[model samples]
Target: MTKPKRFHPFYIVVEFFNVIKYWVIPLALSLVKDELSFSWWQYGMFAILFCLFVFDIIRWRMETYTLTGKTIHVNEGVFTRKVKSIPFSKIQNCNQRTPFLYKVVGVTQLKLDTGMDGDDDTITFHVITIAEARRIQQLIQTKSDSLETKEQQEVEPSVITKEERTLHFSPTAKDLFRASFTSLSMFVVIPILLSLYSKLDELKEIVPIQWVEDQAQSFIVQQTWIMMIVLLIIMVCISFVVGIIRTFLKYGKYEVSSDKTHVYIIQGLLNESSFSIEKKRVQAIVIKQPFLKRLFRIAEVKLISAGGIDHSEAKDDINSLFPFLPRKDAEAMISTILPEYQVISTMHSLPRRSLWYKLSIPSYSWILSTAIIAGLVIWVPALQPYTWLLYGVSAFILLLSVLRKILAYGNTQYVMNGSYIQMKHGGFGTELFLTKRTKVIDVSVERGPIQKWFDLATIVTSNRGKPVLHRFRLSGVPIPLADTFFTWYRERDQEISIVNEDQKK
Candidate 1:
């Protein structure tokens, strides 16, 4: 007897939904054009024809993905069927995303990523059961292990078991409160309130005009102290609500675990997500405590992986693995998880040459402020009282620009023993990044005409996806030394690449 062909049940349903969704948008637009006295024919033709073409194109290109014992095979294309086979050994990471809608349909989306491409170079299988996905992942890993020789296999464990580790420190109510209070949501509220205020006239048409007018008159007559108190209470309430929602969305049920080779993160409230970071793939570790968060001694940790996170899904991935932790605990955790990088103690200072480069040179802010002041003086005489204020502000800005240059001077330090480099500078919200030497893709020393006179150079290091540019005024270091450092960084990166290649072999 022949074996029955197995089919992915959920993918079929997803494709059906996709076809309906394609039509729904055009149908809605057609209705809108008929009701309004607009160019109906143009919109009708574009919407219907465009959607039809998209539907046919997508349907034709859609492929069926199957995970076998040794590799993943994807068969796709319309006029000509194309098949792509990737050996399990080349698979770098597997991610699972379950949306609220997906959960209802008992399916999850699985994305397979490799080291060779950007985050978008992922093969997704929609509408697969979580258990089935895990099973497929294990099978791939097992096949990948079989490719290794006996001696190499013996050096490391054949398989890593998934077990939950008890966290020594869990977030308490106080911790949650501190995190929420320090959140960027506080700043976001001001913009929302301003938008509402601007639309007050329009809102009055919908609301009772008499009631709004009475409230406006009362607001004008209210005592300053009473109004101040009321505003304070309102802001506090808003902050509390924002904090609670941010906490619940970001940190709810967050878990961290590690095996010999990977750090795993499982977190979410409504929709759960799981990701594993291989020790070898990490490029840099950034620990940031914004000005507000510093008051509560809380920091956010980010691991810049080879390809990093997908830009399209940044909001979803921002809270993924990038956990909010106490500053002290985050420091200790980094020491353990990434022993290759060290956190060094150093004072923030800019190179001496930075002073000349910053103050003497023109910046975008200076040009913008000047233009605005010029426009106001020429056109809006009503803003004449603000003229004196602008002059004082410009003077203060000039002083700051000079001070900023002085403060930015610093010695670039590379912690060679741990294979990490640290560059410190002077500025508001100054940061220290610890990145692996091997992860540095390219290093260049750049100097423009302005920098040439001041004897300043900007050192830029390119990782996989984008480059991190660090500007340093030469201060006292000889240009020859800076060139040597650039060469050394490049050489180190090449050496690490060869080593990783050999290990793979």
Candidate 2:
């Protein structure tokens, strides 16, 4: 452990794949830049890739990582020779991601983050053996434990002692089947096929969309409605099968467990990933139940940590715990893993006056839709015959806008206990945001003109988010309740030094 160690040689393959993945768009453009013919541009890209690959090998040879008792030292760079020394305590979260290829190569990627908002806050080991990764992480934990002061531990007495892990949640075959639909995994294929189709404009001779459309029309007329229904059923069947495969690949082999101090999650059938985060480091728990998920009685639960949860891909992210868990199961899982977080079931809705004030607000969407539709009808002579469709679209847009606002008014609610505050808000989807009062970094009460007229206000609470601040807004709350919300936040312990608006009070 005292000697510097070179990264696993297999990392070159990982770097190679990353180069191809990140440079795919540029590579694709080179092939089709001037009407789909290979040119010198492709050769230039190949030369660049070759140089990068050589540099990757050189970088692997030059870089070395050493795990000392107090700190981790990484010496990198060929010409500049940059060096980094990070203390054990500075590591906020450590993650192990084993993509399918990495698993085959007997190596995994390691990421140690400081949980701060900066580029330099993270150290990554692109490839390392499993044993090495665990040893490094264990050394960090042992050192961090030795450094914690007794008085600091006493002040935060909730910290649990080390204990063996206990499994809590895992999906079954039936669960996976249900998740395939509720997870909206079937929709993943649509965007992918559409992107490929968009890029295949040059292959119109091989696969003519116009010819396909004409054939579909002819089939519908010749075979009657029964055949058309059968075609739709077949398409739906294919999507369902695809959804099942996607869900199985992502969560078929998932597990959620907890030890004394940390919650552990492992998922993926092919590309296995394992994550560990201290229970105390969990800033918030986000429970989302979209319209379809609600109908299916399922929810997606994600633990928000200061280390920055990857919101971009829930299924691909290690932060997600068996996504598409049954609603009740999700609640129980949170209680089991992080008991400090409260799952509030009941909350108060906004005052009735708020709804009227919301509806009275001018519909700018209607005006914008009308202007655009009218402009199109005037500019396009062919569309002049079907101006009625433009009006219909405008009306539909207005209806959608109005309906969402109404849903928002209905769905908005908030409830606060001594230590936790829960807010429910969103249109067309239900988002249950629950976080401890001490975890909230910022709180602001806003009053708009409409809110003033209706004696209502908006209360926004901010929390730590991945590379950004996550804010939750509860609009159309009664002014009195807004004050209560503000007061509750102000009461956060003296140790939690926060700027306040005491003078305004």
TM-score of each: 0.75, 0.83
Give the per-residue Cα lDDT of candidate 1 at 305.
63
Off by over 4 Å in 2: 20-50, 145-162, 199-232, 310-315, 376-393, 495-505
Which model scores highest in TM-score? 2
- Whole-model lDDT for model 2 versus the true structure? 0.81
Q: Model 2 clash tally?
A: 1
Model 2, 1-505: lDDT tens digits are 5989999999877788778897886667556655677678678888999999998999899999888768888997899998888887777777788889877888888888777766566788879998889887776665566554445666765663555889998889999989887777887878887998686665654445788768977877899778778988888788888989989998888999888777889888899888888777788998988888888888889888888545553336788777688899899888888888869787888878978877877789898879989999999888998998889999998898788789888899888888789999987788989999889999999988888888888899888877678888888889889888878887786525433343233
Best by lDDT: 2
Question: In angstroms, how far off is 48's CA in candidate 2?
Answer: 4.9
